[model samples]
Target: MTAHAAGRYATALFELAKSSGAADAVEADLSAFRAMLDSSPELAGALASPLHAAEDKVSVLKALAEKAKFNELTLNTFGVAARNGRAGDLGKVASVYAALAAADRGVVTADVQTAAPLTKKQTEALAASLKGAFGREIEVRTDVRPELMGGLIVKVGSRMFDSSLRTKLDGMKTAMKEA
Candidate 1:
């Protein structure tokens, strides 16, 4: 259940879901699955533990998926992961799959961590800026981080632009120490 293995599984699942015309549904299912893992510590531990038998894991997943009404492709992917003894990385796989699906649709997700709440106009402006920079439709998720002191930190994909006062001060302090 290494990150690489999870990424491979995710890529495969994304391709399959795309071809089957259920990419959006599969992504939603995976998002729900990830949320379940986050909210249920016991279930998360069980899924990530290698001590459970494959059959037991599959049964648990089956029950959970049925209750959640996950798409067939998503359920099948989970079963395949269990059978292959890679169930431990299912969460990561789902994450990668969702990101891939978003990218396929020319959508980019921006994580905006700000010192305070942003107005609707601000959010729209930020999204527009990101769209201009990335040349794609941007989905901006806003989060308040009071520790930021002021300004915003915009993260797109693997890149982060930190304009927060806290980060700027930290950088200056580190530079002085190094000097």
Candidate 2:
């Protein structure tokens, strides 16, 4: 149900952004807002908590949007969501909106997690390989997961290729036990 609501909000925002030729700006705004949510737990709680009144949430969102200098479309979307009591779904809405925008542009997002940060050249190589394999332009989103120990994991859409050292070690342990 939350996803449905998020999708509806995202679709509406996407359509508006597309018509206004501000999709990229809106996407950047949402990405920055999501990063803000990640860094500020209080802000997230304020937006998501039922204890906060709708009007209060809208005001908070407005102030933050203005401070961030978000695009007009992004500010309006956030305001509407807050007023509709869907402010909590903003993160999900951003994700959905990004997917919609990428699909419209024939681009695919690859979520890559590596034990350490990838060099710029490595990132470009990986993206190129993915593009060749998928036959579509690839956008590589990378994260450093130290727990992985080594290697990398890549997820594109529903498909995941897990080649992390942690997974390999686990598999080896299982095999040794069976032996």
Candidate 3:
């Protein structure tokens, strides 16, 4: 599906899940759906294929939902998406719904890329700083990227704070060259 269509589906699903008070459960189901997509290329291909008949797709989705033991709300959402011929956008929808729910709960997710593993205290301090800056609870996800050389990159929503040594050197090099 096109990115635009996927975003629309995600927004709609987010709204519905929020209203039903099943946001967390739906997010879990979506996480499972993403894992399934990753593990089964055939399933992903089928879902994204526009040539498939709606009924056939719906039946396959229902079977998968049952096998995965998804809650009623999640199953119904999938059914609705299938019937509407928007099954291709389910993955993106699931992602967007999770983000929306997190935001609604005053939680900000930070993607932290660091040169090395951070100690527990460092992680706690980072989370606290982020919480103070964003005025909300912060959930930090850390990834070790040796390319960073030293320091970390923090991303929350559309804003990013890049303090990695590699980035700093690159900026300085660019400035020197320009001068």
Tell me each candidate's RMSD, in Å, in order: 3.5, 2.5, 4.3
TM-scores, in order shown? 0.74, 0.83, 0.66
Shift of residue 135 alpha carbon in model 2, Å: 1.6
lDDT for each residue of candidate 2 in 48-110, tens digit (9 for 90 to 100): 999999999989889999999999999999999998899999988988888888888899988
Q: Mark the 10 consecutive residues where model 1 has the least summed lDDT.
A: 94-103
The total of clashing pairs for model 2 equals 0
Model 1: runs farther than 4 Å from truth? 111-125, 141-153, 163-179
Worst 10-residue lDDT window, candidate 2? 94-103
**Pick by lDDT: which candidate is best?**
2
Better candidate number, 2 or 3, judged by lDDT: 2
Which is better, 1 or 3, measured by lDDT? 1
Q: Number of clashing residue pairs in every model?
A: 0, 0, 1
Taking the tens digit of each residue's C-alpha lDDT, what string does model 3 give over 17-132? 77888778888899899889867879988987988998888999999999999978888878888888888778777767667777787788887999999999999999999988
By lDDT, rank the candidates, best first.
Answer: 2, 1, 3
**Which of 1 and 3 is the better model by TM-score?**
1
- For residues 1-179, what per-residue lDDT tens digits would candidate 1 score against the true structure? 38899999999889888898988899999989988987787998898788999878888998899999999998888899888888878988977886787788788888799999999999999999889898889978676889999999998999999899999999999999999
Q: Name the Cα RMSD for model 2.
A: 2.5
